[model samples]
Target: MKITHYCLSALLLFAVAGCDRLEQDMLSVPDDTTLDRYGLDTLKLGDKRAEVGKQLDALLDKPMQCTPGKTGLGDKRKAYLLEECSGVPVAGEVGKLWGEKLSFFKAVFVEDQLCSLELQLKTSGDYAALYEAHGKKIINLFGKPDEANAKGVRWQREGDEAVLKDLGDGNISFEIRNKKVVQALHHKG
Candidate 1:
């Protein structure tokens, strides 16, 4: 009787260990390099609108002020403005550099998923300095710009784009957009 009990206990332990190993194997991370590289605050391309909204709420720690559009791509998407970072009232170190002079962001989503993020400077300081500072920051994150000019600097990876544009007014635009969505919008237009 004692030997049988010991054998049953060993079998149960082995079964549990095997199940854990199988679970780990089944739940391995995906091999898509773009997915591995492209993400912000738990938000990523192709996420469902509801999921992105939840993440936005979690990141902002408050229900964001959202405006739904009635025309254009805005019809399929919603915009949220000026959201601060999660778990912090103020922007982080890097965010502070641009956030100080820049107004809050305008985050855009299509079919309920984030497709673009835009930020406008409330007051364009020395255009040279603003461009250089944010340009360096974008490069640091996304590698060298694919296109750089007086108008703007653009960096792209896996159909995702980042642009820092001097719109030639007090308004400076920093835009990150999903390339696929941009193409779709252009095609519609």
Candidate 2:
């Protein structure tokens, strides 16, 4: 009976120690490889427009093409289009054909802060294929998306978000934004 009690006590102590180690490992923060590094160039979430605009100017060696304005498209937020800039990074064969064929992009702002950036591709053939392939590539680079549907795929990390959408008629749009802004838009709708 004494040996049995000793053995049970020892087992209980080992189990408690093992659980503590597991808990500590689970609570520790991951490295910088996640969505934290997933913004457009230096334009990240929570950045003011003036600072981001300066960074954009430094990249383009010129000023933004358009001032921020409301789109009346339901979001009620303003936007700026950064035209013909070395902006977003493309994926797969589609990326190779982007600038040479057709490419356009915009940076979205709300209250003088960059909340989102958008990239679009206009092509006649294989648009669906390219969009699907790009979505898969985003998954590979940023892990599995947070929300996915027939319309689009979204990935989020620590309140920042990224999305790829099929705009139909051979057009695809990719947007990344701050989580607060995304939540606000969703709430508005």
Candidate 3:
């Protein structure tokens, strides 16, 4: 009857409105917390070598050594290494990446633009325990990783990627890279 038709129309209208709201929420960009979770706010990928050098100089205990060579990907790259910069904090505001200590930090630049960052966590004993704990912490912050296995976990966003790998020793390697830049370089050659 007439009442049934009216009810059906009203329900359809409400459903459409709800779907629009949901779509908007899903499309919304992530906030600053996302950037902080991956240390992108400070050591952002795709930055120039000089810019990164200034940031590293402020955080590291001493100057890192830069070596020029070709990367495994066959791109001309510059790799910077800080071997003994333990306990040096890098991430802004959050500090020390959930209080885990670091043994070394590295930055790799392709064509003078930074493409990746690598950090090794320092631990005395129980490497697996520390790795599991850090993985849980990262999952809590960034949700489930895109890929995970016994040795590593990776989370990839639109233009960047973050990875946590178990080195089978008393350390874990955490790395972040710019996927867009890497893909572009690969295509160029």
TM-score result, candidate 1: 0.48
lDDT of each: 0.47, 0.48, 0.52
Considering lDDT, which of the candidate structures 1 and 2 is the better prediction for this target? 2
Question: In lDDT terms, how accurate is model 3?
Answer: 0.52
Per-residue lDDT for 43-146 in model 1, tens only? 66556667776654543423556655422333455332222222223442112223434444556665566677665554544433443344333333454445
Candidate 2 deviant stretches above 4 angstroms: 1-33, 41-43, 47-63, 68-104, 110-113, 127-137, 182-189
Write one digit per residue (lDDT tens) for candidate 2, span 39-88. 65445766877787766544332344654343323354644332122344
- Residue 162, candidate 3: alpha-carbon lDDT: 82
Better of 1 and 2 by TM-score: 1
lDDT of 3 by residue, 1-189 (tens): 332232211221111123333233324535434554344445567777777677755545555666565433425353332121223434422123345566667776776777777777655445434433443344444443566555666777777788776675545677777776555443221
Find the candidate with the highest lDDT and give its number: 3
- What's each prediction's TM-score? 0.48, 0.47, 0.51
Give the winner by lDDT: 2 or 3.
3
Cα lDDT of candidate 1 equals 0.47
C-alpha RMSD by candidate, in order: 19.3, 15.0, 13.9
